[model samples]
Target: MISDKEKPEGTPKILPLCYKVAEHENIIWVCDGAANVGQIGHQIGVLLTNMDKARMCCTTAVAAGSKPHLDIAARSKKNIVIDGCGNRCASKVLENAAVKIGYSIDISKYLQKVPTLDIYQADVKRIAEIVVKEAHL
Candidate 1:
């Protein structure tokens, strides 16, 4: 039997692209807009500290049928998807097109009990720390 802490043999601990992008120090990070309302956005920033730029997709454009373009965008470079909830709209959009997801961070499931933090500069920094720690980045 496998231990809880053990990952399947050959499975990468971090996203493959994350490792690849980290090598260049210029990868793009993408976040779902659902997470833009509060500390989640800030947390994303923290998680993105290792990247060249981080952008938020605040609309359903990709989910609304622009999946090809989104896939194209994701393919243009290493991509990490951060979804605020488990609905995983962002991951789904990319996965459906057979695109590989470098990393996926779900905030709703991470801080299940913490009260919503107001979307502020400080809050963003705080949340970003949580995300970075969780991702071990």
Candidate 2:
């Protein structure tokens, strides 16, 4: 099992980068629960200046109907789906809405190469960076 130690300190306390960027531009962060605890959320949160401007959604198969998820899918431009594993729950959520994914990141593929990296803070950061870089964020 992945150790909780691998996660960044105050993981649940951090935010997502997308949110941070959104805030800087007076936009919002539309995130899915697939990034529940890690650098992905932190990177995204750094972009959030206000809670009302940032939105969090459940990408899980069951929580797909949540308002946050629906709101995100309905309005997001160039949707980005960050999946914690190969299940690709977030991607499916957007696809179901007939929303095309402009970019995607699968953490499971990274973990396979860097087995020692914790899925928490550092791993999340690395993945988020890659996603942002790839997406030109």
Candidate 3:
């Protein structure tokens, strides 16, 4: 069994998508900000890729001026933008580019009335399911 600290040696860690990207490779997907505000978006990104149901384009890729990544995103037939907080960095990227996002999920909305910055596994899964439903995938 793989411990939390160990990944199969040859396994390619998920690329942060900062460089080149395959042409129109993934269909249904997300472009996460992957920021450290609360890690909610990062957790959602891991779940998004791990489930094998969708793809993720990192905000870093767009920020770094990767045309292929931007092209892929702009042409994507479907996309779910998940923002970690009201700052809306990830969503703003799509909007700025005029990329039509099919859906948007903001992690801050899931916060309790008191509003804490912490999020748990269950919260991530719940948000993922919500995205899956919204995207109809």
Candidate 4:
């Protein structure tokens, strides 16, 4: 179990249980790749989740064929996919599993892709705002 002491100061001590409440949640799946856009996409997911606008789930688990995660995606009210670039890796994972995606966006459209993990909070907020408006979150 995760302890509050282990989490960052401003982070939530406990988050909404995504699996148990997926049917009423807008689930976010982001590509956490080794690039600026990818990192920004990930932060955007986290931002939306922390703001209670959506819940970010494990795209890696879905890619690895986790049945529980796949079921959660299947039952979610909306699946919001955020991809780093034109690759659309996160979206493809859900599509391959036959999971319906209610909303999807490629971060490259808003930011230039760079081969670095470093990202800015400003970019995250900017992209997150776009997602909230576009995805109707």
lDDT of each: 0.49, 0.47, 0.60, 0.89
Mark the regions of model 3 whose C-alpha exceeds 4 Å error after superposition. Answer: 1-38, 112-118
Candidate number of the best lDDT: 4
- Weakest lDDT window of 10 consecutive positions for candidate 2: 22-31
Off by over 4 Å in 2: 1-63, 66-71, 113-118
Per-residue lDDT of 70 in model 3: 76
The residue-by-residue lDDT of candidate 2 on 1-137, one tens digit each, is 11122446565544454333432332222333333432344344343222323334344421456654455555554455566556666566667766656667766677653323233556555655565567655
Deviation from native of the Cα of residue 19 in model 2, angstroms? 14
Better of 1 and 4 by TM-score: 4
* Residue 127 accuracy (lDDT) in model 2: 59
**Candidate 3 C-alpha lDDT tens digits along 73-131:** 77665666777777777777777776777777776687542244455766667776776
For each candidate in turn, give its C-alpha RMSD to the true structure in angstroms: 11.7, 8.3, 5.1, 4.9
How many residue pairs clash (N, CA or C atoms closer than 3 angstroms) in each of the candidate models, in the order given?
Answer: 3, 19, 0, 0
